[model samples]
Target: MTIDHFFQAAKIEGFQSPYDTIHLKIFYPARMPSQVEINREILPVDLEKAPFPVVIFFNGFNCDAQQYQWLAVKLAEHGLVVILFNWIAEVMPGIISLTPGIDVEKRKPTIYRTVPTASALPALLAKVEQLQSEGILAGMLDLQRIILGGHSAGGRVAIENADPDFFPQIAASFGYGLHTMATLSLGYEADTILPLPDSLPLLLMGGTCDGIIANSCDRYGISPGNATTPVIRTFQEAITGGRNDSYLLLLEGANHFSINQPDSTLKTPLLDFPATQPQESFRLLMGEIINLFIDTHVRHQPEASQSLEQLLNTPNPLIKSFERK
Candidate 1:
């Protein structure tokens, strides 16, 4: 669904999940930034059909979950229940506006927060179960088809969580039949290479202009004049080392800020290249690519698989490179 359509759909009456104690803030993508505190809105879905897949998305470092609503909303429109959960700390409404004299550190995470990144998934899953038990998502969730996704620092969480070696203890704790079907990382990567098991899948999407994470000159190498990332190196290792379920997509002209909410205007040390395409177009492309990827790997939709194949084979202005092993 288009962004406008997503807003229209939100206006229609739908189930409003009760105060979610675990999910501090949730939003149904709107024309403006509007959040539903302690609750989540399940966009209009056909009740006669099977329940929708679940997507729990965490925001990048120093960014609010609402900044990624452009993505959460679109995913919901395309038949998934998207949950945008915030990290332990985020910018308040007041701080974002009183910015001219604000210290650089004040704009971002000022406190040293230490919630084990691995705990994010399990904590969220417990909250989801609580919501379901309370009839918020009763009979409307296909708990089997769950996907864990995140951006930047959040992406690191998803990547590390998917690896059996990183969080074996956490995985063992979730013996309640809940598992991450796949992991999608955007604008983030591990310091070392991490390859998923043959049964699980990985999709890594980042921008060529992402000066923050994509800053390594070569795989596992870094140079001062370069703006590449370790994600590329790790992704290459996954495919070459025989992880046949891995996939990677590089957005040509997109940047770290491009994936955030359109309303954001905070400045950063990262460079902002002149856009060759409209900003919203990039967000749409991101949503479309993510939707198709989830459908093919998580939902196992044949049509989505075909579409992904075409997008990879045929060159597009937006997609710099698409690869699957």
Candidate 2:
């Protein structure tokens, strides 16, 4: 956990699949090179921090990977590898970019905005192999240490696909503004509330002022606002394996898009309904907590266990609520 490494991103164009050519924008710790890639000032990957853990992420609906660069770079500076992909809404590109499992109906996932593609782990793992062969991150990726994480609906996909039997390499799963509460469209009596992930260690987070979940009532038919704290509730009631490794957190004055940058009104979305706290302030606290989870659960650091408990239990200006099962 030091931010001594300078991070940089590189783009790699094609990993063929039935859905689309899966493109990636990877963020990793790098060193300035004297002879950089032609037009762009691409630097060489930092071999000093070789075999770093990987974080393959999914973004919220109507959002692109670039919006999450703030979080990606934060993780990268701490010597982790972060990967994001090129995705589109197909019809409107930026207006309604859709992601898989984001629009599940009757417990069956749908293709919203006409992309006709799924953001499953298979496609992403294929790309990681391609990145290795292409020499961008050659011999530097640690397959044994991986985490699948996302935001909002993108978070839903991460939770759904975290299968230990299938993707054994993924050590943990996390989602900010995400939960497994069954929805009306998913054939559950509206807001049936608690259906937790049993496969992976999960980190579910939300904000008190998260207006997005309220707005989501129409599409998914889950409980609105604080009628019940579904995020914390899901973590509380979860059974064996997932329960032992899970954590629930609520940010005091944050919003759905707090993990995103406050760089521009254009870059962030109006659908978020305005975040109460400064995004960076929120993410500074977010990054520290996220790293703790990754370091403890994913990397299996024995020392981090004590620090994680103390940080969550102690008083802090940023944290509003905390629970662990």
Candidate 3:
């Protein structure tokens, strides 16, 4: 469908038009040391409310906090507060020398060379706590309802942070690739992959077309088909086995870049696929789907789940959705 058509459909579902009142602010807490210092951006909704559901986004390698600005704005418009972070340095100091042609800003070139997952988690958790304590996320911020997500390497970090046992087996099978791999191989200790704390809900999104980090199913070992399946299975296993509340969505023809704003400047060595789905349509559909999920899971809005069920079963070639068992 055309981008205009998609926007019209989104509006029909209560999706708000993109609003820029969404401000991104950085917070520095004096309690942490310089290296452990946190860089977080708070995107508040236009509505004047005390509390809002919170979504903390961990961006992929080479990507900065601004990469998901469009998404943050869209979600905020739906009454959700979105936060994105630059947990790792924007540019890896020396990875450019080893991996040429990789986009430093978008793809997170340095993340491929070192493992910063363990080091990054505490800062993220701290930021969440700080927001709660200071009332920056006061009434609007629903501590009981939180969604943690990321892309590519950031996805790996999120999973590892959520469950340490997550990658140990995979790491045993395939040595570290660049950054994350190198670090995992060094045998740094990490927190156990316990069920997501009751206070935090989990959402995992990744490109079905990512091939940079290859493994078992595909020859390169990094094919999306291989990477996504294991991650999804692991997440499902954790949630289902624990009977925890969680949700998962896999965009069929989407790649790593689909989740980020289409206008980002970073480019990677991977093939840039054609826009099988119009960018605006994809964004609108994604925004609406996410809203539905949060409304039902976070806010206890039953009607939102019914509407989302219709959207998921709509049989549109451009979009698809699934619920974890």
Candidate 4:
């Protein structure tokens, strides 16, 4: 678990559904890379210290992988092999332009229909197995430590699909099934009949002032913000159900778009809020805390355990409150 590692970037466009084309943007620790697409092109880095933990991150509705590059680089710096890909096909082009007649409610069912709740697990698992077998990523993947996560609609997908009992179709669909170590949902929750498997550790994170979706209040019954659907109920359900390993974080004065990157052209409605806190401040906070959380749960790093405890006890103004149960 070496924190001092430089990440090498690569873009491969093979992972896809039968009808859609999926592009996987990967970041891995490398001594050097033969070429750099976005940053710089360097020779291949020594991967003697390879087989890093995997994080399959799904982007929010209409958001693409490029939007989350900032967070991915930070995770890659800490010896994580991060994969960010476009899970849905239709949400694009429109998301970039904010065209007229764009409604989240109308778009959600499209997402539900296009994006399989559990198909991604087997698709990614097969892709990984193929890459490793061909020696392209021989020792660069740690499948056993995989974490499935996403934001907004993508987050809901992670939650709904992670239920092994509810969506057993994915297991039977593919020959090999994935055993995800944990699940992380950012600023969103699903309205699922089946709860997340008790064995799976879950992390629900959101902002108190998120005008898009209020996490501070029980907004399901009472409409207070732009979000018609609330996710706080999921947190309450997990906490009271005796899932001592689950956790929730509510960031103070942060909005729904705080963790997302602003498009230079399109005016995202979520970003229309007044800025009380610097955007990078939220990104740094999220990256650092998420890194520590993953380190504690995935790598079993004792230092992260101690640091998390210390940070949790020593309160800060940014974090309004947290429930670790």
Candidate 5:
């Protein structure tokens, strides 16, 4: 599937997810020079301050990291270190863009059937260490407060690989338009869902009208509208509800590409509903909701749960449904 997306991207400058794909882009809160905005400048690490929470985001299938810079900026603006990356593999001899070079094509399972997505963490940490060594982000990161997140396929990689028992530094895991349902090739069975890490805090976001998940069902020879509510079921089934709290947030009138704009023309929304809200509005609300989740899980703020409860219990036009467990 990864190679299939690449071939589509190679045909056009803007097909699938092509161009400006960075293997790594780390955003941090820092003093901007004279008049430049936050993301416009990237130096003078705020070493005197306390350790900043870290967030590493993986990209969706064939999705580039550049498009999510807005999100990185949003999170970093709130004093978090956000790292965006891709799982670029050397599929053919000479094709490479946006992939983090992790050789995920083999699709081999590690101990207990987990994919090799965890392999990307070491490289990510190494880069963080390099930045600190150069005094770029020195003393500004707390690896112990790490949160792993992603969208769609990338989100699955994060949730599946985030093992706090194995990698205690990870504080939590989150996903947007993500699920753990295996395709036919991956041996998915009825009523079976991928297991999440032990006692891991989770946040799963979904859309009531996520046409991409529904429309893409044909790839596995399944019906088009089968997976319209897969994220909700994923949350109900995968969450190991003890020691850590988990949440499910379904947005009203949202689609698969709601977190960010449709980056490529290849995105087929034939099965999606007309977006009731603008993408900008969707992202602003998403940023605030993510802030609450991170504050509750990673920052250990008991007060954050109050805001979350308000959103979950009170009726809202933005959220179709909200539940906690």
Candidate 6:
């Protein structure tokens, strides 16, 4: 609830106190049905600067825009413009029910219904472009340097939008297991998903202990029998065909819940996921890694690359890093 709780839950450390200048602005989609309008929140770094790199993040199933506030703030703190998007379908069942009877079991819930990755891209791109034209994003945002990332179901959205062919290739490369089960449950067929356009940079992050997704993939019978590498590899392969850069990182000892903000009382199960390091340590590690990843790739800061390399080589049994071919 509190900003401190958000940062702490995200495992952000080494700060004497919380930064107070993080600003938020919300944008409502222009033409979608009220039930389907997208909500975007912009968080700019507390410091003054011209044209920073921008990161537009999408949230996972049943999660609201705040789910990514911690990560977005972290990126903004490092001098990037961060935008968190809330998919209207994920939160509007009442409106969906009014349209026609919806099958909760057979059809994906409104929130889980497959959205064309392309459908949302233009709206998002236009928002940033508008900011540039109006001078709000002004010198601080480098229009050319943008990164897209997400978690759990949101991660699927990110990849699907970047390259629709991602899931099918994942299905084919990994075999019919957990990955397949997830694909089937989501109602995605190998033939229907599209490919990513040549313009966007992508980064895929997954936790070692991601129970829902990895477990689902495992139960369905995907390769590696667990959630770790197979999904990551699929994403790496999908983005390689585009001109944009791509990278996949596996946070060692981290579970799906750990990546989000912990509750104020810190009593949430998010604090208890099994990991080699204590929960806080792993969270901080993940935050730092994310910071470095955005800095190196989005901001074009060469020094950030060294930090990433050092973290990768560190003898942490829980972490793994890979670059797409």
120-212, model 1: which lDDT tens digit per residue?
456566655554565435566766666767766566455435544432322111010011111222222323343433335677776766665
For each candidate, the alpha-carbon lDDT, in order, equals: 0.51, 0.67, 0.45, 0.54, 0.67, 0.46
* C-alpha TM-score for every candidate: 0.67, 0.80, 0.59, 0.71, 0.80, 0.61
Q: Which 10 consecutive positions of candidate 2 have the poorest summed lDDT?
A: 3-12
> Per-residue lDDT tens digits of candidate 3, residues 1-325?
0000000000111112331011223321112223433442222223343365556555666666566666666666666556665432213443321111122222133342233233434444455556667643444455645554456555544444443232221110100111122222223233112233222344554434434432323322233335355445545554453333355665565654676664445555254444455656666777787777667666768899799778877787664445643
Q: Could you tell me the lDDT of residue 103 within candidate 4?
A: 24
For every candidate, C-alpha RMSD to the true structure in Å: 10.7, 5.3, 13.6, 8.4, 7.4, 12.5
lDDT of 6 by residue, 53-164 (tens): 5665655444555755667656655565666654333224333110111123332434333534323444565666666776334444567665555555555544444432
Candidate 1 versus the native: TM-score?
Answer: 0.67
Of the candidates numbered 1 and 6, which has the greater TM-score value?
1
Where is the poorest 10-residue window by lDDT in model 3? Answer: 1-10
Candidates 1 and 4 compared: the better one by lDDT is 4
* Number of backbone collisions per candidate: 7, 0, 26, 9, 5, 19
Cα lDDT of candidate 5 equals 0.67
Model 2 misses residue 276 by how many Å? 3.4
The digit string of per-residue lDDT tens for model 4 on 55-109 reads 7676665666678888778888877767776544333444331111112331243
Q: With candidate 3 superimposed using the best TM-score fit, by how many Å does residue 210's alpha carbon deviate from the native?
A: 3.7
